[model samples]
Target: MSDPTFSVRPLDEDTWPAFAQLVEANNGVWGGCWCMGFHVRLKGRTAAQNRAEKQERVREGRTHASLVLDGDQCLGWCQFGSPAELPEVKSRRLYEKGLTKLPEWRITCFFTGKGLRRRGVADAALGGALTEIAREGGGLVEGYPEETDDRAVSGSFLHTGPMAAFENHGFTRTRPISPHRWVVTRTVSPT
Candidate 1:
């Protein structure tokens, strides 16, 4: 899973097949999340319904992601969006309490294939997301990564990724939204 041959690419309609395959391999990511947890209004909707809604978003170019791929197969991805596109903050009150200014884009979640976990896939995905953000006229890019040393927590709980990855990409910790999650940010090279 630590293959250095993999490369990063932005998700688009053309690459949807590979992305769908990866999602299928992971069983919809976090038990049928379909990477829609942060984007949808999740009240009363079933997972299947949310998945369908997310699929529509992706089809409409509303959903954005940077994917780590081996050839045509997507191994992992980092989800990103404008604050308006994904306003479901993990600790909404805490985030609002510490809020200084809103970021232009947010790094919401990450998903790597089952066997691909711990293989630097999330790192690649975050990096890819940053690159794409820069390409689209860079702005403040925010991220939420857990700050924990406990391996007892299932990796599934780490969909936001680890703080080290954010730091590696020059994201500075701005505030702690929760005991386990921190809001980190970096400015992408803007045109």
Candidate 2:
């Protein structure tokens, strides 16, 4: 087992490739669709188009982003920015309603490489995200996680971390849009 100590830092050119690779590595679960389900719905677009659009957003997001790492390996990332900065999140029907009522950061998808699971990586990632947001003087950080009994009991989600990891990082349940979806938040600053 690797040491539990790792650093979290702002996403940059040097760090993005590893993040993209990890996302691609999980193509079956997160690939094909461009990670755009929470951002936009491409009614008739081809998979390539979806991938391109998502990659474009990701390229932009890297400059204004947060990521977790164990040495040089990108362990996880939390994609957050202004609603305008993130068209996908801003345009999503489920996320559009209560936005801008406060300044917030969104915790998007998380990915960990094989053999890296069940080792507190998610908690470390979330902690890094919170601290970085605080350093940047951002407002609250938000997360939308699937609510599931099996996850609550076991704290696993294929390669994705479970909701309890967010909760363990001080995120409280704000609302549940459906039995499987929830909105949670942890306010980092009053502004």
Candidate 3:
């Protein structure tokens, strides 16, 4: 099949609602996160509450990029920013095991609409991010892709990305922070 064409632009107030809907649709398996599981502390609340909390958090602050759209419809969401912008990631218990250094650009989250899975939307989104980063000509783009020995968790569960997907875009495994989490980096050179 031919690849679908879509554009990945920074999130704007105009597109945030569609992005939220896309995120909610994935919550059935992603567990009501709205892709906020990593960004905000859940504080032992229910998934619905966590979702509500994240929505509030989104309102209170600015995000680097939060919307991915195909024409007028939102198809995916990718949360990224400079390492300093993502203060919450610095305190995640999962990140403390072996991550002593910080990345230049942190890819904290991702979500694709229900109908758009297994499509090339993610690669397109990553490419768009790279284009923007390259244009700025600063910062190393980084990702935390899931690594799994368990067969059940290997598929679909690697929602952020699988090693192959990142590698496919020139990201290399810089370190294995945990058994199922990796520090992946790819330096972008502007053309």
Candidate 4:
């Protein structure tokens, strides 16, 4: 088959169906996270709750993301928002301790179809997010990604995305959130 075309768009009201389909296609992404890993603490919660909460935020215009679309079909996404918007980070207590500076925006999670992994889907998603940030008058952008290593927790587990993806976008390792993960950032001011 020919290489699938790649592109991304901001997740808006019109694109909710595509985003919903993408998450539902993955069975709610990460045991039913519904891409709310950083939006809410998902412990002791059902997948239905996660899905509802995520959709609600989207409707309220509180959540943000860049959707990697293969021609109207969303195959991947990069979740981002202000620090206050995505307060429930994975290693919150730990990640916050080292957060000396609060970023204007934070890139919290990423999801790509199973078949799209090992390709550039996530990279495109990240690029799309940065583009959106620039459009919004670029400021400090933060992200959480685990350092590359031979670990059992790889693949879909790297929801925050790989460090290489961030580095490719000029993000630098700022602090260590855990033994494996880190808080990275890059400034994007207007031209």
Q: What C-alpha lDDT do the candidate models reach, one value each?
A: 0.86, 0.61, 0.66, 0.85
Off by over 4 Å in 2: 1-3, 33-39, 42-65, 87-103, 151-161
Top of the candidates by TM-score: 1
Instruction: Order the numbered candidates by lDDT, best leading.
Output: 1, 4, 3, 2
lDDT of 2 by residue, 54-76 (tens): 66766676334456677777766
Q: Give the range of the ten consecutive residues with the poorest summed lDDT in model 1.
A: 148-157
Q: Which stretches of candidate 4 lie over 4 Å from their true place?
A: 1-4, 150-153
lDDT of 3 by residue, 84-163 (tens): 66656522576666667676778766666666777766666666667666765646788887765545563455666666
Tell me the spans in candidate 1 whose CA falls farther than 4 Å from its real position: none
Q: List the residue pairs that clash in candidate 3.
A: none
Per residue, candidate 4 scores C-alpha lDDT tens digits across 57-120 of 8888889999988888888889999989988777779877877788999999989876767668
Clashes by residue pair, model 1: none
Q: What CA root-mean-square deviation does each model show from the true structure?
A: 1.7, 4.3, 3.6, 2.4
TM-score of 1: 0.93
Candidate 1, residues 1-191, lDDT tens digits: the string is 24688889888877788888888777777677788888865667776876677778878999899989999879899999999899887888999998989999999998888887777898888888988998888999999999876656677778898888899899999999887899999999965
Against the true structure, candidate 2 reaches a TM-score of 0.71
List ranges where model 3 is wrong by over 4 Å: 1-4, 27-29, 45-61, 89-94, 135-137, 148-156, 189-191
